[model samples]
Target: MALREQLDADMKTALREKDSLKLSTVRMIKSAMKYKETEPGAAGPLDDAGILQVITSEIKKRRDSVTEYEKAGRSDLADKEKAEIAVLQHYLPEQLTAAELEKAVADAIAEAGAEGPRDMGKVMKVLTPRIQGRADGKVAADLVKQKLAT
Candidate 1:
């Protein structure tokens, strides 16, 4: 099923189960997707990859919120954000393990002929699409840096 259909089905299930957290998170994601659809020059409905991109962006926002809440010593709010992250994560592809990510970065570096830190851009250009929503950009970049530095 398409992401739209899947989300709709899940939203109905959440409603039936009276899962307030899940209902709110699904609504938030739906709102974001609606905004994307209405954006200037948007080509109408988003494909699976586009939906995944949106989901990933939402996850990132929740993670940032969690960090801010933690720093402000609001464990309550941080826990909420973490819960939202967990709910949203169900739609995303399985994340790459550290070793898998390392291998992917190494492969990109080799394929891009990236020999030094200066070639980071080249490696990232070749690597980003492959990892996409499956890996955290910051973690993958750090891994790339570690590999390059060695």
Candidate 2:
């Protein structure tokens, strides 16, 4: 099934099971999808790739909020954000490990013939699509910079 369909099904399941966290996360994703559809110039319903991007962005936002909450000594709010992040993460593709990400960066560098940090853009242009939804852009960029600097 498509990601959106699966999400809808899961939303029903969450309601049946009384899973508030899952239900809330699914509803949030649906809201984002709906917002995208209603946006000016949105041509059609989002594809799986677009849905994945939206989900990943939501997860990232939660993580960042969690960090900020923790830094402000608000453990209660941080814990809530962490829980939501964990629930949202279930819909994302399996994340690449640091080692796996490093290898991907190396391969991308070689594929793009990236020579120095100056070629970071070229490497990123080649790598983004391959790693999308599987890895965080900041993490990938850091790895790419590390590889190119070596």
Candidate 3:
């Protein structure tokens, strides 16, 4: 099934099960997708890839919130953010292992003939589409920098 259908099914399931956290998170995802659809120049309703992008963005935001909440010694809030992360993560493609990501970076570097940091853009251009929601962009960029620096 497509992601949108899956989301719909999950939304129904959440409602039936009375899973408030899950229901809220699914609603939030739907809201984000709707916002994206209505954004200026949006190309109509989001496809699975676009939905995944939104889900990934939501996960990233929660991760940042978790960090801030932790810093303020708000364990409760941090835990809630973490739970939300878990809920959002359920929709993501299987994440790349660190080794897999490193290999992918190496492959992209070679494919792009990226000799140094200056070629970061080229490498990323080739890399980003491959990793997409499967890997974190920041971590991938850092790996690229580290590999290129050596």
lDDT (CA) for every model shown?
0.93, 0.90, 0.97
On residues 1-150, what C-alpha lDDT tens digit does candidate 1 reach at each position? 888899999999999999999999999999999899899999999888899889999999999999999999999999999999999999988999988998899899999998899999999999999999899998999988888888
Candidate 1's C-alpha runs over 4 A off are none
- TM-scores for every predicted model: 0.96, 0.94, 0.98
Candidate 3 whole-model C-alpha lDDT, 0 to 1:
0.97
When summed lDDT is taken over every stretch of 10 residues in candidate 3, the lowest stretch is: 84-93
What's model 1's overall lDDT? Answer: 0.93
Q: Show pairs that collide, candidate 2.
A: none
TM-score of candidate 2 versus the correct structure, residues matched by position: 0.94
- Give the alpha carbon lDDT tens digit for every residue of 32-129 in model 3: 99999999999999999999999999999999999999999999999999999999999999999999999999999999999999999999999999
Model 1 TM-score, 2 decimals: 0.96
Ranking by lDDT: 3, 1, 2
The numbered model that scores best in TM-score is 3
Model 3, stretches more than 4 Å misplaced? none
Best by lDDT: 3
